[model samples]
Structures are given as structure tokens and as C-alpha cells.
Target: MSRSARAIAVNAALVLAAGLTLLPLAWMVSVSLMPTGEASRLPLRLLPSAPTLEHYRTLFTRLDVAGYAANSALLATAVTAISLVLNSMAGYAFAKLPFRGRDALFRTLLAALVIPAQVGMLPLFLMLKGMGLINTYAGVVIPGLASIFGIFLVRQYAQSIPDSLLDAARIDGAGELRIYRSFVLPACTPILTTLALFTFMGTWNDFLWPLIVLSDQDRFTLPVALANLLGEHAQDVELMMAGSVLTVAPMVVLFLALQRYYVAGVVSGSVKG
Candidate 1:
């Protein structure tokens, strides 16, 4: 094939793939707007024959989806805040501090990442149960309170900080905590923003662990509660779409808002490595 022909083929293939990927999102919106019971009819309807917001209304008013939405928002925000403080400090210390066995310790923790978190999940659930954390916001908030990737992300970014900065802080009577809070943390705003986005989105979209831990209806995040909603309201296609929208929209918006940071982190890490 000629070079021009190959380029055309590649572009065509990309467009096709993009369309294929977007098909479900398109269908979800279409099905969500459809009136009470028309999505599963004989001929596939690409758009709602008569689009309506009744399903969205039902989700908010009758079905109590708003509660689940609030739970997801609060849990994600809390986890993001906590993860920022814990991971950023740990990352900075690892990057800049002089400590014995620091590399070994970080390596050990990194190795733990290879061990699927799910492996300990059963024991974790039992441990949480023992602590009476299950069925509570703390249960949802605890596991994500810190993450290996978060540390690694901040560490990567912190490694870029000049030692002169920390030395300057120390000469001015700054403690380690003070140095981190004033110098390192602010220096890491770009990456911290990136990590915050990552943590929030991960915590918001979390399904499995939350499903296992939060057995109480009141504590269910949007994904878990939506699953339960599916069981009872499978026939409500539009409603399910609305739930899917509510579940996905916040995450999509967050990524768009902070995409610069996410992209910067990726690029910086790549160059640093």
C-alpha cells in the first residue's frame, strides 16, 4: 500500500474505533430519555421516540438516587482530602529526607502493590467488622485514605524539587512538617491536584469494595446503590440511564477540569524516568 493510502486507512480505523467506543454512552443517553417502557422494543430506537425527564425525576424524588449521589460525592471528597495530606508527606519524605533504609522500605511497599489489594480484602472486611467500621462512611473512606500510586505520583513530582529549597527552609527554623506544608506541598500543587483528581475519581467510581462493605442502603455509593436499583427497577431503562449519568458525569467533569495536571504528571513522569 502507498503511504497516503495507509494513512487514510489508519485514520478511518481510528474513527471507527472511536464510534464503537462511544456507542454505549450514546445508547445510555438515548435510553435514559425514553419514556417509561420503550427502550427494549422490537426495532432498536437510536433516540427516544418521545424523550422525557420523568426517569430523572423518579431517580431524584421517588427512588432516592440523590442520596446515593451525595454519598458518592462526600466519600470521594473526604478520601481526596485525606489522601493528599498523607501521600504528599510520605512522598516528599521519601524523595528528599535522609533516612536509613528508605529505599528498601519504599521498595517493600511497592512490592506490596503487586499483591492485589483484593487478596487482603476478606481479612480487611473482617478487620473492619471487628472495628465496627463496616456499614459506615468510615468503611468507605478508610481503604482509599492512602494509596501506593498516590505516594508514587507525589514522590515523582517531589523528586524534581531542589534540595536548596528544603535546606533554605531548615536554615529558617522550619520543621519537617513546616517545610512540607509551606515549601514542598506548595511546590507540589500541580501533582497534588493531579493526585486529588485521581483519588476522587477512583473513590467515586469504586464498586466492588464498597459493595462488599456497605450493606446498609443508606451508606451505599452511587454505583452500589445503582446496582441494587437495577435489581428492583430493571424495567426502568430511562431511570437506569439517569443513574448512569449521575454516576459518570462528575468523574468526567473532574477529569476535564484537571486534565492539564493529569497530562502533566504523565509527561513529567515519562521524562523523569
Candidate 2:
């Protein structure tokens, strides 16, 4: 085929794939706006005849979804913020600083990534319980504060920084923290934004860890609360769809807002590393 024809064919295929991927999410929003029993009706209505916000109203007003959403927001924000600091610092140190056994330690951490996260959950849970953090937001946030993948991502990106720049900063009597604040952090903004989005989305969508840690209904995050909503309202498809929308919408908006930075970070990190 000619190049122009091939380009047209590829574009058409991409559009089709994009439509297929988005169809379910579009149906979900459609169903959520539908009247209570409309979603469950025969032929599976793709769109509502008359959309309403009543289900959304019910979620916020009656179900205390606001509280659960708040919990999710708080935890996701906390974990993302803390992880950025910890991960970036560790990454910069790995990339720039000369510490004894640093390479070995980083290699060990990378190796640990091969181990399943689920395997460590039991021990981690026990450790948290011993610390009296069980059923608290801290329990959820603590484990996510430092991750091997986050550290690796930051380290790879930070390695792209010029050593001469850091040396110059040090020659001017800049301390490690000062240099990191002024030089490293600014240079690493793209990767950090990417990490922030990843951490936030992971924390927000997390269900198993929160369910395992928080026994209190009031402490439940959106995903956990949504699961509970499912159990109680299995037959209420519209209500469940509304809850799903709530759980998904924030992350969608966040991703959309940071898409440029995210793509840049991933591309730069890959090329630099």
C-alpha cells in the first residue's frame, strides 16, 4: 500500500480502537444518568431518554459518599505528597550522591520489586498493627510513602541531571538540602508530576489495603465504600453506576490535566535512563 493510504488506514484503526475503549465508560455515564430501573431493562439501553442527577444526589446526600470521597482525597493526597519527597530524595541520592553501598542498596530494592507486593502485605499489616496504626489513615499512607518503582523512576530521571551543576552548587557552599531544593527538584518536576499522578491514582483506586486496615465504616475510602455500596445495592444498577462514576471521574480529570507532563516525564525518563 502507498504511504498515504497506510497512514489513513492506521488513523482509522486508532479511531476505532479509541471508540471501543471509551464505549464502556460512555455507557457507564449514560446508565448512571438513567432512571433507577432503566439500566436493568432489556436490550441494555446505551443512553438514557431523560438523564437525571437523582442517583448522584442520593449518593452524596443519603449514602455519605462525601465522607468516603473525603477520605480517599485526603489519603491519596497525603500518600502522593509524602512519596514524592521520599522517592525524589532517594532517587537523587542514588543518582548523584556517593554513599557507601548505595548501588548495592538500590539494586537490592530493584530486586525486591520482583517480589509480589501481596506477599509483604501480611507482614506489613502485622507491623502496622503493632504500631497501633490499624484502622487509621496513617496505616494506609505509610506503606505507600516509599515505593521501589517510584524510587527507580526518580533515580532514572535524576541521573539525567548534570553532575557539574550539582558540583557548582556545592562549590558555592550550597548544602545538600539547599541544592536538592533549588536544583534537583526543579530539574525533576516532570518526573515528579508523573509520580504524583501515579501515586494519587494508585492510592485513590486502592481497595484491598484500605479494606484490610480500616475496619471503621467512616474511614472507608471511595473504592472500599463503593464495594460496600455494591453489596447492599446489587440490584440498584443506576446507583452503582453513579458511584462508579464518582470513583473514576476525579482520576480521569487529574490525568487529563497532567497528560502533557505525564507523557513528557515518561518519554524523558525512558530516553535518559
Candidate 3:
């Protein structure tokens, strides 16, 4: 094929692929807007005969979805903010600071990553229970405050920062914390943005940990609350779709807003580190 033809072919294929990927999400929104029985009709209507916000209204007004959403927002925000600081500090230390056994400790952490997270959950749960943190938001946020993967990502990106910059800051009488605040954080912005997106999405979509930790219905996050909603309203297909949309919408918006930074961070981190 000629070059122009190949380019046209590739673009067509990409458009087709994008449409296929988005079709389900489009259908999901459609179903959520559908009247009560419209989604489950015999023909499987792709579009609602009469779109309405009834299901969404029901979710927010009667089902307390707004409260659950609030809980999710609070937890996700807290986890993302705290984890970024902890991860960035640790990552920078690993990359630049001369500390005793730093390499060994980092290596050990990497090795631990090979072990399944589920394996440690039981002990972690027990430890938290002993501390009387069970059924609290802290229980959910504590475990996610520092992750091996987060630390690794930050360390790799931090390593790409020129050593002379840090040395220059130090020579000018900048303390370690000052240098971190003024220089390291700014230089690592792309990676940090990427990390923030990952952390927020992960925490927002998390279901299992919240389910295990929070027994109170009022304390439940969106995912856990949605699951509970499913059990009680299995036949309410439209309502369920609305709930799913609510749960998913925030993350979609977040990703869209930060997409450029996210892509840049991933590309830079991979190539530089």
C-alpha cells in the first residue's frame, strides 16, 4: 500500500476501535436514562424510548447515593493526598539521599511487591482491629498511604532529575526539606500528577477493603454501597445502571481532566527511569 493509503487505513482502524470501546459506556448511560422497564425489554433497547432522570433522582433522593458518594470522595481525596507526600519523600530519598541500607531496603520492598496484596490483608486487618481502627475511614486510608508501586514510580522519576540541581540547592544553604519543597516537587510534577490520578482512581474504585472494614451502612463508600444496592434491587435494572453511572462518572471526569499530564508522566518516567 502507498504511504498515504496506509495512514488513512490506520486512522480508520483507530476510529473504529475507539467507537467499539465507547459503545458500552454509551449504552450504560442510555440504560440509566431509560424508563424503569425499558432496559430489560425483549429487544434490549440500545436507546431509551423515553429518557428520564427518574432513576438518578431515585438514587440521590431515596437511596442516599449522595452520602455514599461523599464518603467515596472524602476517602479517595485523603488517600491520594497523604500517599503522594509519603511516596514522594520515600522515592526522593531512595533516588538521591545517601542513607544506610537504602538500596537493600528498596530491594526488599520490590521483592515484597511480588507477594500478593491479599496475603497481607488478613494480618493488616488484625493489626488494625487491635488498634481499634476497624469500621473507620482510617482503616481504609491507612493501608493505601504508602504503596510499593507508588514509591517505585516516584523513585524512578526522581532519579531522572539532574543531581547538580539538588547539589546546587544544598550549596546555597537550602535544607533537605526546603530543596524537596522548592525543587524536587516542582521537577517531579508530571510524575506526581500521574501518581495522583492513579491513587485517586484506585481508591475510588476500591470495594473489597472498604467492604471488609466498614460494617456500618453510613460509612460505606460508593462501590460498597453500590454492591449493597445491587443485592436489594437486582430487578431494578435502570436504577442499577444509574448507580453504576454515578460511581463511574467522577473517575471519568478526573481522567479526562488530567489526561495530558498523565500521559506525559508515564512516558517520561518510563524512558528516563
Over 1-273, each residue of candidate 1 has an lDDT whose tens digit, in order, gives 999999999999999999999999888888888987788787878988888889889888997888989999999999999989999989988899969999999988878877887898999999999999989999889998888878888898898899998898899898988888888888999899988877888899889999998988988999999899999988777788889988888887888888998787777656734
TM accuracy, model 3 = 0.92
lDDT of 3 by residue, 1-273 (tens): 999999999999999999999998998899999999988789768999988999999988999999999999999999999999999999999999978999999999988887887888999999999999999999999989998888998898888889899999999999999999999999989889899998999999998899999999999999999999999999998899999999999989988998897787667556733
CA RMSD of all predictions: 2.0, 1.9, 2.0
lDDT value, residue 256 of candidate 1: 83
TM-score, cand. 1 vs. native = 0.93
TM agreement with the true structure for every prediction: 0.93, 0.93, 0.92
Candidate 1: segments with Cα more than 4 A from true spot:
1-7, 264-273
Residue pairs with backbone atoms closer than 3 Å in model 1 (clashes): none
Clash number for each model: 0, 0, 0
lDDT score of residue 18 within candidate 1: 99
Error of 3 at 245 (Å): 0.6
- Per-residue lDDT, model 1, residue 200, is 83
Model 2 misses residue 87 by how many Å?
0.9
